[model samples]
Target: MAGFANLSQAARTWSIGFMEFDPQNAFNNAGAVLRQLSALLVSYSLSFVGAVLLLVIGYLVAGLVERWLNAALAHIHGFDLTLRNFFSKIARYAILVLVFIMVLGQFGVQTASIIAAIGAVGLAIGLALQGTLQNIAAGVMLLVLRPFRIGEDVQVGSIRGTINEIGLFATSLHTSDGLYILAPNSSLWSQPVTNYTRNQTRSNAITVRIKPDADIDQAQRALIRLAQSDSRVLADKTPSASVSEVADDAVTLTLTYWTAVGDFGGTKNDLTKRAKLTLDQQGLSKV
Candidate 1:
């Protein structure tokens, strides 16, 4: 019985010791886990704060740089406004990309790998957007060479309108008939462009047909008088009248005059109407 009691006591003591050790080990493990979690949270919080600061400061600096560049370009003599805006925007975006890389670095991201991936993606995009890239190239050339300017009347391909805006990818035009046109920069650069507003004055040719025997001299004098009386006609360039063609039953009288470019269409219409009226008053009948 004594031996049996001693064995029971030893067993109880071992059970108690095991129970105490397990709880203490569990508490220690819990404490270790909490400590690791706190350290991880602290690391992440610092990284997040750093990233936010970088983003805010970077965006502010980018905007300031863009504005400063624009102002500086505006002061340059003969610099195109479209070019200035394009360059400023490019600068701002470049700065933003740098800031993004820095922010990623704060989070322990590998920047070299990211740059390589971006390059690969960029190559794919460039291949996919060949036409778009061409337009951008053409746009750069256009801005630098200045074939046409904003608010100028120009005709390219089948499009005719006043230039509303010029951008890196396309050109906007406002037509005389109240329509808007967006033309790709590549097409404009490749095709021939007709600029109507480049010249201060434009020549207008007005032809009137009268009866072959119906006083050619009188008809000529009447046309010349009509052109000269018009205020839109250039005073320095005197109107000239000549017999261009002599048909069987009709004589063609050509009146050439110079007028302000803006007034060319209206002046031509008015002169033709007046010429017809003048010939009727002179008893000249049309063929």
Candidate 2:
């Protein structure tokens, strides 16, 4: 306030001295004006330096807080990695916003007015970004409800892939054939999610048609032996072999077994190959 007053008074004195054409008064006014200008420059220079220091310190503090918050959240059980990162970023941004407000206050700006204006702008932005906000909301719900986790294979609507990353706006996935997919959270949240890896065990079946003349009992015994011999098949559930259909030229033998979900693919392929060999050895070749 005093700096502003001195500057304004010096300007008025200079104007009056020039209008009167008084050489002595003008010389004195010139000195006063220079002094006021020097004082203002020094004051502003200090404020500018202080603002820069505040910015540097505030940025470092924000980064430290983000890291500390992330590390602290890591200890909580069942806390999703996505949520931890999101929350830590929010904290860092909040701190930076406060530091910015403080820096503005150093420039003689009204902090309360700035805060109010910020709120107004935030409201406007929220209104403008409804779809984006929906994605964020859906992302939060996804993290909370845990429909799928990283590295899990899932099918949502028409998209089938392994979960790569769950973010505020989108979920990243890699297809079985290794195609990258960036699906919006809103799309995932609105669809039915099929978590293929959620269950510990999965049931699979292999059906093959045998020669009509083949011995049904022998064929069933061969499939059962093949299932039992494989270590990947779950021991808890007994494998089943049944004559599913009988036709004029062929008979269908269906073998069903339960295997660990992790081994479902390999088990299916291995068992199928072995089943065909076993049936052929038993003289029950397909029609």
Candidate 3:
């Protein structure tokens, strides 16, 4: 209140000096005071107008962005979350940046030179971090093609593990041995990748042995029966067992079965165990 009273008096009273003044000097001093007051009012009005205009434009842009996001990103997973953050902040900041630049231009500031200076600095920084820039580019490519994502068990180069995250420079994986590995994006992009979980089914080949005296026909029948009876095994294609090789004391047989991905290992182990028990009961060799 005190400050406001003092400013009000300052604007109201503009006597130039205590000494007597000529008419011309008196007119000049009063003109100077009125000009200062007019400038102050113009500055305040423009600032208020800019703020209100910014709010209105911001609201309208927000509505348009929301509608466009819904229409454009309907099929994308996590798109709402991603673009909600991206657009709201990016658009509003862009508006503010433009407004600020325009206001500066009105005050006789050169924006092009400022922009050029920033670009030059960015170019220098990019050149200094060339390797990091390549990694970021590779990461973008991987994300776009989506060769593998988090939770897929993949083999890249000599590394085999479930991917945990994909970042700007590296992909993190959790190995079967319970170790975490950070693979550079450049390396991942350079290697051949195999994603095991991409398919719903997996086939495994099991090698078993039987006595030479045992009927090859009976052993094949038992192997097929073992695979068929197991609920996890896929039976549309018949499980096959054949005399693949002849060992010194046993006939080596190869049994191949198709199973669901989740049951691959368990089905193989169960089938192998059941084949052993059936062979033993039939007096086949333990080999």
Candidate 4:
């Protein structure tokens, strides 16, 4: 009976010791877990705050830099407004991109890997949008070379209109009949472009068919007088009239004159009408 009591007491003591150890170990593990969690929260909070601050500062800095660049470009002589805006926009985006990368770094992200991935994506996108990329490239060249400017009348391909706006990928035009046209920069850059308003003076040729039996000398004189009387004609450029072609039906009289570029269309129409009237008065009938 003594031996059995001693065994029971020993078992109870072992059970109590095990219970105490288990509770102590569990408490220690919980404390350690809480400490680690607190540290993690602190680190994450700081990173979040830093990233937010960086983003705000970066945005403000970008705006300021853009404004400063625009002002500086405005002071430059002969700088195009479109180019100025484009460059300012590029600068702002570049700064913002840098700030974003820095913010990512603050969060322990691998910036180098991200940049590489971005490059790969950009390359893929470039290949997919080859035509669009070409237009952008052509637009940049157009802005630099300045083959034409806004508000100028130009003929590109089969489209003739006045340039309303020049954009990064396309150009807008307004036609004489009140139609709007959007032309890709690539098309304009690849083809021949005729700018009607580039020069100050334009040459006009008017051909009038007169009866073969009509007095040629009288007709020529009348044509020259009519051209000289027109206010739009450049007086310094003397008008000339001659027989260009002789046909079985009639003789073609050619009148060559110079006029101000702006007055070319109006002058040509008026001169043709006046020449017909003058020929009629001279008893010369057009065939």
lDDT of 4 at 238: 97
Q: Which of the numbered candidates is closest to the native, going by highest TM-score?
A: 4
Q: Model 1, range 1-287, lDDT digits (tens) per residue?
A: 99999999999999998877877779999999999999999999999999999999999999999999999999988788878988999999999999999999998999999999989999999999999999999999988888899989999989999999889999999999999899999999999899998888999998989987888888888889888999999989999999999989899999999999889889989998898888888888483
TM-score: model 4 vs. ground truth: 0.77
- lDDT per model, in order? 0.92, 0.93, 0.79, 0.92
For candidate 3, give the lDDT. Answer: 0.79
What residue runs in model 3 are displaced by over 4 Å at the alpha carbon?
A: 1-99, 211-215, 246-251, 283-286
**Model 2 per-residue lDDT tens digits across residues 125-236:** 9999999999999999999899999999999999999999999899999998989999999999999999999888899999977899988988888889889989998889
For model 4, residues 84-126, the per-residue Cα lDDT tens digits are 9999999999999999999999999999999999899999999
Clashing pairs for predicted structure model 3, backbone only:
none
Instruction: Output the lDDT of residue 42, model 4.
Output: 100
RMSD of each: 6.6, 9.4, 9.3, 5.4
Off by over 4 Å in 4: 1-53, 77-82, 213-215
Q: Which residue ranges in model 1 land beyond 4 Å of their true spot?
A: 1-64, 77-82, 96-115
Q: How accurate locally is residue 159 in candidate 4, as Cα lDDT from 0 to 100?
A: 88
Per-structure clash totals for the candidates: 0, 0, 0, 0
- In model 2, pairs of residues that clash are none
